[model samples]
Target: MRKPVLTIFYQFNPWSTTIGGIQTLINIFIKYAPPEFAVRLVGTANDKTQPILKWQSAEFAGKEISFLPLFSLKNDNVRSLIPTTVKYTAALLGQCFESDFMHFHRLEPTLAALNWQGEKTLFIHNDIHTQMQTVRDKKAILWRRFPAAYFAVESLLVPQFSQILSCNTDAVKHYKERYKSVSDRVAYIKNSYDNELFYPLNQEEKEVEKRELAQKLGLPDDTRFVLFAGRLHPQKDPTLLVRAIAALNDPCVHLLIAGDGELAAQVRTEIDTSGLTGRVTMLGAVPIAQLAQLHRICNVFVLSSAYEGLPLVVLEALASGTPVVTTECGETPKLLTSNSGIVCRQRTSECIADALRKVLQHPEDYPIESCVETAQPYAARTVVRDIYSEMLNRWEQRVTFAVKV
Candidate 1:
């Protein structure tokens, strides 16, 4: 029999700026996906481009992963006027109509799945319920100032989908409580990382990579940097880390900030106001390969995000054998055992400062072996195989029902 066709609905353009955790997840899925299913990744073009129907990626071992352009509709004139997101949503919906199974990876595609009658699965990266609640507190649509309309629309649609692939226990609980009808269908699969690219570097290897990176980044050899890599936005709480660093008052310690967003000005302002100008360097938006190197070299990886589904940077840090100091977000506590890293008791600067100090003081406590072992379960092959297994079983049940009739 022919392999089951699974059309994945998501957006990503390596040629564009959206290469965050979602893109990383897609890369892993492409890499470790089993051969039992024929995969078609139906992603939207960031810019106006013709549709892309490509062959399998040899690097990823993916089968016929195609990029469907959102703007290229059957009606050219009307397609031009279709709003980009709407066009993207339409493209995903179009693919769902023909595929054996549908896998949605973002909120827009999830909303689009409302119209798709198939054995569909949801892959949520953000806490939608928390976001909607935030909108309520701010009394703004965040979409406009907050979106009363988006909340209403998502409220109507999300509960109807049976199978949801949750990244953490908290997400699974949220889905179960909110949608009791589909509670049994919510499955917990932790996020994954590229084991080949990011792994524990030996002491000799670490020293070399650190020195090379420092030279490339124009830093002194003595700098013991704490790395914070994520968008500098309210949700990510980069300011919290900056505050903690300033409070530490250690001359040997320095802060290195990567990635940029709306809170860039605020972060710079915090650095200047705290008199940490010379110590904090904003290395805005390094390449992913460079990011892996940074993770390998840094004394500690800090994630002060207010929330996350499961921050990919955290996984990458653990995989790179770097100890982490972080607020409890997503699967962080689940991922970090006592032997691996430190999880702060509170979100305040003082609490974070104390945690960082403890980690910095005890280099002997967190072995490279423990960190790598913690990350082993989250390897791309292991997690991706489980997702495929769950999806394949569901598809088989659907096939059985079809055959019965």
Candidate 2:
């Protein structure tokens, strides 16, 4: 019998600026999909005008890979709102016409599965329900109608899928509790890092890149830089990080904000007003190639996210032999148990400041090499195999049940 063809749909490309935890999960799916399964990765280009297709026949340690891009029809930040609806609508209609099974990676594609009329697997990365609720609760959405609209749209779509693959244990538990279905329909699979691209930097390479990075960012060789990778959005809470750094009152403790987002202006304003301009360096967006150097140069990495489903930057930082100081959200505490890093009790500026200070003071005690070793199990290859084995076992059980029937 022929192997099953799995169609994996994502809202954005893996290389895009918005790439983070969700993107990492998609990359792992591409890396770890079983060889017996022919995988088709579907995503939209940041723009809304063209379709893209990237094919790879070679396996990542015996797992096959392929990519398909369905660009949005409009060129706007609301690409997911418009292009995703159109592209995924077409994708679903096409899939239904041909009759195929699909596994979608985010909320937008969950809508597509409603019309797919096939076995649908929903991969919930960042919960749209939570996001919409957050904006509404904080009154950040401004227009009361939009939050209601998003909530209604989400309510109309998310529950229609056949199965849901949650990114972390907390998410799985939340879904099961919310939906009142604790069965295999909602399963927890923690994300993994791309060890091929993100790993421990050697001493020589680290020294060279650290000096070069300091030079490029206009930092003194003695400056102690803490890194904040990922988006500069309200959710990421870079402003909170700035407040935390300011509260620390340590002149030597500098912060480097990597990546860009909608709240860039606000973050800059916070840094300026707080008089942390000299202490905080905004590197904007650093290339993936230079990320290791950035991680190496920093004394520690920090993630001040309001929420997360296992932030991939944390894993990347750990893999790069850098201890982390992150907010205690999602799976952070699980990873921090071994003293690889410190998990703040809350996302408050005071808590974050205390955590940062504690880590900075005992940098030597927080073994970077130990952090790297701790993160190895979550490497892309290893996680991929775990996922494949999970899916394969489930499939085998279904086959056995069918045979008995």
Candidate 3:
């Protein structure tokens, strides 16, 4: 029997843009797709010049990588929203006319997927419902909260999906409470990272790499680097690290931030205005290669996000045998067991600063071996394979029952 082809609908392709965690998640699967199945990815074209209906393909890890890019559009405006979404989904449905399963990545794609036919499964990456709700409740800028109105509408149809893979406990809890009728369908599925690139380096290897990284960034040998690599938006609260570091007043401790978002300028201003000038280096939106090295070379990996579905950066940091200080977002608190890391009681900068100081003061308490071991189960290959098997089993069983009828 031929393997079932899984069609995935995602907004961003790793090849097309600088979006990190989601892009990294897709790239890991692309690199390690199982031979038991063929994969198809449909996404919007990042390059405006690329005409619609264009596609590219290659054989990766003994599996076919079929990617089709539809025309991208602005979802902020009300008038063009529905029409553009129709065009996007129509284009997607045109390519994958038949499939065993259809995977929806984000909320926007899920809206479009309502028109596409298949055994649909939702892979929740972020708490879109709450994220959107925050925008709505806070009365954020019109452009920012425009999609909340759409999600609020399409959410009425969420019960149609038979399966939902929640990447964190919070997401699972959210689904259970939000969709009471379909609560039983939601299952926890931990997000994964590329272990091959993010694993811990031995002391000798780390020292060598650290020196090289230091020289590349023109930092002193004695500097203790703290890393935060995520969107500089309000949700991520990148300046929390700046404020924390500023309060610590540890001259030996430096912060390297690598991301860009709505509050990018504010992140810079916070570091500058707080006199964290020489201690902070904001390298807006770094490539994945350098980011992996940053994980291994840095002293601590911290995520100050107010809320996250499952921040892949936390896993990457753990995999690199680097201690972390993060908010109680997603599965972060559960993952920071023992002394492997510190979990902030709250999202306040003071909480982050206190946690940072403790982690730095007693760095020896966090064992490198345990940190790496904690991330072993979440390797991209294993997690992807597990999700693939579960989906295929359900699909194959569904097909068998249909044939019997």
Q: Which candidate is the best by lDDT?
A: 3
Q: State the displacement of the C-alpha of residue 138, model 2, in Å, after optimal TM-score superposition.
A: 4.4
Candidate 3: residue 210 lDDT (0-100): 74
Worst 10 residues of 3 by lDDT: 74-83
Highest TM-score model number: 3
lDDT of 3 by residue, 326-347 (tens): 8886677887777679888877
Considering TM-score, which of the candidate structures 1 and 3 is the better prediction for this target? 3
Clashing pairs in 2: 48-72
Q: Which portions of model 2 show Cα errors greater than 4 Å?
A: 15-18, 46-67, 72-101, 115-118, 127-160, 202-208, 393-405
Q: How do all the candidates rank in terms of lDDT, highest first?
A: 3, 1, 2
Clash-forming residue pairs, model 3: none
Candidate order by decreasing TM-score: 3, 1, 2
lDDT of 1 by residue, 18-58 (tens): 43687778777776778787766665444444445432332
Model 3 gets an lDDT of 0.74
Candidate 2 C-alpha lDDT tens digits along 1-405: 556667777656554545356665666677666667777766655554334544434333356556556544322222232344456656544343212457766565465456556567777665444545554125323323377665566567766767787766777877777666435578876678878777776656666766676677677766677899887656777888999999999987788888776678889999999998888887776666677667766778998876677778888888888888988766767886456888887778999889889888987677767888778877888778876776666666766787899
Candidate 3 to truth, TM: 0.87
Could you tell me how far off, in angstroms, the CA of residue 192 lies in candidate 1 after the best superposition?
Answer: 1.2
Q: Once superposed on the true structure, which residue ranges of model 1 sit more than 4 Å away at CA? A: 15-17, 46-64, 71-98, 134-151, 400-404
Consecutive 10-residue window with the lowest summed lDDT within model 1: 72-81
